[model samples]
Target: PEDSSRAASVVICMNTDRIRGAPMAEAEPTRTPQVDSRAILEMDRLHVSVDGATIVQDVSFSLRPGERLALVGESGSGKTVTALSIMRLFDAAGMETRGEIRFEGKNVLTMGMPAIRALRGARVGMIFQEPMTALNPLKTIGAQIAEVLVRHEGLGGEALRRRVRELLEQVRLPEPLRVMRAMPHQLSGGQRQRAMIAMAIACNPTLLIADEPTTALDAGLRKTIMDLLVDLQQRLGMSLLLITHDLPVVRRYADRVLVMREGRIVESGRTDEIFARPGDGYTRTLLEARQVDSMVDAVDESAEERLSCRDLGVTVGKRRWIGRDTLTEIIRGIDLSLHAGQTVGVVGESGSGKTTLALALLRLMDGARGEIRLDGMRVDGLPEKRFRRYRRDLQVVFQDPFGALSPRMNIAQIVGEGLDVHEPGLSRGETRERIRAALTEVGLDPSVMSRYPHEFSGGQRQRIAIARALILKPKVLILDEPTSALDAAVQLQVLRLLRDLQQSHGLTYLLITHDLAVVRALAHRVLVMLDGEVIESGSTGTLLEQPTHDYTRQLIDSALMT
Candidate 1:
């Protein structure tokens, strides 16, 4: 998995011309289309309901030919359901829809199943948020790309293969031959997403619906993918419909924006006007840029380090059944210092060894040839039995809370599991009280301690994970991609909570993420890693503004800043 993420960083950066494409604000067209007086896609007074619950009520919008319209909203705002209604995907899911969805002056809701199937890939194409799940796992990349071609264009054999490779080249993916032969699991996240885009645009659909297309990519790759979409839209002369929670992206690409909240469109206007002067309170709140106080000045340099590592190196190797196995160096000559009541941001694209460095510092691996010190004491070379006591002093919060927290375990058991091992002598009443305190500290309802992880939203589950880590009262926390999966509104909330907790408890944090905005808000110091080494390190304000390395500069420039 680490290798995959790393490969993404390496491949995308290796040939900027191939993946990044030309830096054109506008696309040049190859051909002109006859003007259509009617809107390309229009939804009037649309209503979407699942069972007896109304999710979307009276939503309306329209897209002109070759125009880009962005539907902006947080999670559970019915943005996705509205988009799905256009293609009549709700029918397969047993969801009810009402009102008119007119594409080319024909109602999509009144179409038969056979007609809808023909309309899907042939006339309307959609790029899902998560490509790994949307794509067929058992099929090769070529087969998935060719499926849409064969069904929609009626091509077969060499013609289909040729078209597939051309589409792959059109999306700017490197090495068409290698990519075609690879399975979904073999390719990286960016690669899978590019392949998905190729499949969607195979037939040159009239409308391209990109639902959070770059959600899983790092800042550089996000820019690349978005630019690629724009390039394709201009070349094909098709309208673009983008659905996302990323406000920066909306500002950068969308000609117009529709702000949605709780299944209703509260505001709609020109992109620049809406951003400059938002009429809706909710829109203003969504666009508000949070300012976080850095702890660098508050922290005393003379004080002992909370966590520090020196010459840390991690070599990954496989055990051989017959002879000596091969080994590869993952992390090399890594060194950093973290002080109490401060946050250090480790930033790089996927597969840059940021996670691997965190793993080494967490001491989650063995054969690490380096010195790891916690609270001015050595811990790396200690034996398992002797080092067991130090486990409570170090804790980590993972990226995906849904995956990190067990589905079968309730909130109380999940949070108090650490205490069961460290403080086994405590009474049940004390344990329950501690659990409640931990939950309350992270802004969760203490009464929900009996509920399971599945009962909460993405933001709520992340808070639960934070509670689980806080219950141990660790001096340092290693957060790996903590807010990348959350909505913009929810991400700010979590960052604020982390900041408040750090101020009150004097906790140290190692924030590992690809989000430059998050780094700006919370991190006092920043480390830019590439290919298993720290390329640059300095104060956050200084490093970000005056980056010395070209890679660091590229990272900052690629970020979708507000």
Candidate 2:
């Protein structure tokens, strides 16, 4: 495992032996008792290693029947690995696991291949982190869900189709019949996640392992998914093992909380007690980091406008064999302006056209129509050759840093590519100096420039992405969900870095994200979007505190609840 010191200070490691031997004390009377019922799953001194490197070390935890147990930690903390080990999902050739994993009085480690296969869906089901990758894109949603039922229960034909539709309805999916025929890509993020949940619960497994189930979902959708999971678990009388970095969700949904650091349990107790008075410093830091403060400074209204858009719209569709092709408008008529040194946050749920608007503003989308002005120059209608001059002035940091970055390129090549394209006159030595400066600005070591993206952590990769965007010294930077992939502590660090950079360089930012807390932290103004339209816009404090639009109010309430 990578050194724990590389992680955020909020995820400090504690003594592993003490955590393994100690018993959870009684929590405050205000909180629910920690697992008084019968235990359905028990992991005692579990140790997992990959290629002879220890990832999970002497970890121990238990899940009571019908109870919610949360395994909370940052990335590389062995939360996912421990959960995957329960189902023997890791490659046996390269991975080694020791210690006891008991489910219903049966040892899982000694189970044969046939027994493991029978146990996976029928007794223990899992909902992976990324539903898009988990669900087969080529297969219909009904066929995917029915596969589990047919394999485990031997139901086929009409009975299989009927059960699949029933499962979709149980998960509260709309248009069950249509959803049954729809492919994974045809559904929205929340709908795809719901379908994955339906598949996991298709067999009515005694235990369900949800790995960051709501990681990429917006506040409203996240709340809905959490509620659905709780309702289903209660109705079906199954144990829930939730692995996530979201502390608020753990506090609200989990009965018992286990805080992990460097593959060891640092703290374990009732959720309320853990949040109320954490025993470890790491836990306290994690709790404190969740509280975000406003960082918007006083704005100069008379400052020069860095970017402006008029009647911006984007429509996309596919060709059909018969009749005219259907087009769905992604971004509606949007009129907005951003002044130099100001940060404007566009907040919305998935498919709200936030990303579409960002792409349209940057002229990256093919079907975008409308006026896009940068630095008092209209470049929206410019041809590709003519638009090259404006590309350096406008840069974008995408949501997924890993996806946005080239896997084959090293940090120096990735960050310096902008300079090579925009400033061809600059010498190689000059380009290297600029890359080093940008890396230092984003809190990353310049020595790692030779390393590929896979060598760095998620937070580091995001920093590298920022370095790449900043290397151009753009007048307008479009940040799309820049910090959503990080843990709370790392997110706080990134937000602070952005605020500092904005103040130091007078950088203008178009922040597009579903995270209201991030918007609250850095945005001077906020625009609420719903169904491809900007429903509300105002100062961050005014809009978030007293939102007039019902959709905006719903978003805020859901965020606060989580």
Kindly list the per-residue Cα lDDT of model 1 for residues 1-562, writing each as its tens digit: 1122111111110101132232332442232243654688889999887676778999998888988889988777878778877876644245777899999888999998777766663577777665665667788999877766555557799977877787778766777987898888655455677887777656566787888777646777776677777876775567889998878778888888999998999999988899999999999888874333343435666655899999999886677899988566877999989988888999997667787788788877655789999998999888878888888888999765666788889999999999999899999999999999999999988999999985666679899999999998999999987887677888888988998898888888999998888888889889999988999999899999899999999898877342
| Residue ranges of candidate 1 with Cα displaced over 4 Å | 1-35, 49-54, 88-97, 103-121, 130-205, 290-297, 315-329, 363-369, 376-390, 401-435, 447-457, 560-562
Give candidate 2's total backbone clashes.
0
lDDT of each: 0.78, 0.80
Per-model clash counts, in order, read: 2, 0
The TM-score of predicted model 2 comes to 0.83
- Predicted structure with the largest TM-score when compared to the true one: 2
Which window of ten consecutive residues has the lowest lDDT sum in model 1?
7-16
Compute each candidate's TM-score over C-alphas. Answer: 0.78, 0.83
Minimal lDDT window, size 10, model 2: 6-15
lDDT of 2 by residue, 408-511 (tens): 99999999999888899998899899999999999988999999986666778899999999999899999988987678888898999999999988999999
